[model samples]
Target: MTPATENPWAFFDRLYCISLRDRTDRRERARIEFSHMGIEMRVEFVLVDKDHNDPCRGIFASHLLCMKKAIDAGARQWVVFEDDVVFHRYDPHILKDAVTHLSNGSTWTLLFFGCLIKGSSKTGNPRVKRIRYQALAHAYAVNRAFGEKILSQPWCGVPYDTMLRELSDDYLGTTPFFAFQSNAKTDNEACLGLDRFRRCFGGLGLIQLMNEFFHAHRLWVILGHLAVLTGLGVCIW
Candidate 1:
């Protein structure tokens, strides 16, 4: 009675990873992770030296460059990864489920591998939920159409991930997310003028665990927060 879902990968054409030439550490980590997951991908270079400019511009340009290359290479759907990507709960079978929630014969514009996304989905498979936008972009898939749309947008010095946040439709994400960013030095801190490898609270394992739970039961977590807020309100009254 429902359209049989296909693994999100079923919809992709090719995978590409964006990496800065100097960050061999991140590239190596991603390489090992992919080898473990049986992922094959091409590497795209982020040649911009983000030190002198707003790093967001460099990020946006890097993403656009990858998209251009993918489209040029005849890939209608492309999956892009940053070197910080860390896989979780990956199974080949999770690759075969379908998550088409748009409409009859409609397709998604963007699909997140890991993100701090907002909202829920009752229509699609629970494992594949529709979402509003990405708070993070370590990993995601994009259709050529949406990729072109993104390319068309003016960077204007805004954080590229912030630009992603304004998208409210045609976005889908996996639950128990297939990947997340590891606690590695990244633009998350560099953009703030912080030094590389900033020590995160509770360390890398804690960060990964937080993403695991959030991806698995984000709605419940949101509701729990709301309940606590309401209880506090009642106590104050």
Candidate 2:
């Protein structure tokens, strides 16, 4: 039996729908969609509580805290969702199976759907097969062992991509990491909105555009745009 069959709601259990204070509707949709599917999950609003003036670090810190909470709850598997993601043609069963495949493989340090498609340069260990970029936390899952591995790693004071690169190189070297292919051909991304991050920040230069296109996995761009716009949030709810 699958994990969801045992718990019915196991896929959604301990899921944290990370969002800003202004994104109540986005949170609501994510929460309701999962609930309707008999997946027990909750939405927790997150924002900088104080005027620290550091938006980037604050967001990462909040994610770490929420992830720790899920781990503490004895969650063997957990999903992290950003506000703007909407599953148009997604089947919960298929998603569950995909996650199970990665988890059961046991060689991967992380399983995510968003990342830049790149070739792996660091080659030493035979455990890993190849390297690709763009694994975003949005709509991603981490097995129990992966959680522990991440927790044990030192927190790097950089963007999520840099941190993932470092972690993949050091820990998951040569391991196969499953990340989503973002183009229209991979999956039916009907509800997926425009790639705003590429439009906004990517215009600085070719290197910058290429870097963001492949590195951040564009999940943050989707979620960040959702938070900024109240009603424009794409949702699975």
Candidate number with greatest TM-score: 1
Instruction: Give the alpha carbon lDDT tens digit for every residue of 136-224 in model 1.
Output: 78788887888888878887767778887774466777665678777665554444433232244643435545755675587799999
Report the poorest 10 consecutive residues by lDDT, candidate 1.
191-200
TM-score of predicted structure 1: 0.77
For candidate 2, the TM-score is 0.56
Tens digit of per-residue lDDT, candidate 2, span 1-237: 464345423544466656666656656765665565455335444442421454445555656666687788888767666554444334445455444444454455544433344544433333332345444455555566666766665545565555665665422211223222222211113212334443344321233235434433456767777786755544432
The residue pairs found clashing in candidate 1 are 5-97, 5-98, 6-97, 6-98, 7-95, 7-96, 7-97
- Number of the predicted model whose lDDT against the real structure is largest: 1
Local distance difference test, candidate 2 = 0.48
Cα lDDT listed for each candidate: 0.68, 0.48
Using all chains and alpha carbons, the TM-scores for the candidates as numbered come to: 0.77, 0.56
Please report how far candidate 1 places residue 2 from its true position, in Å.
Answer: 17
Cα RMSDs, all models:
4.7, 13.9
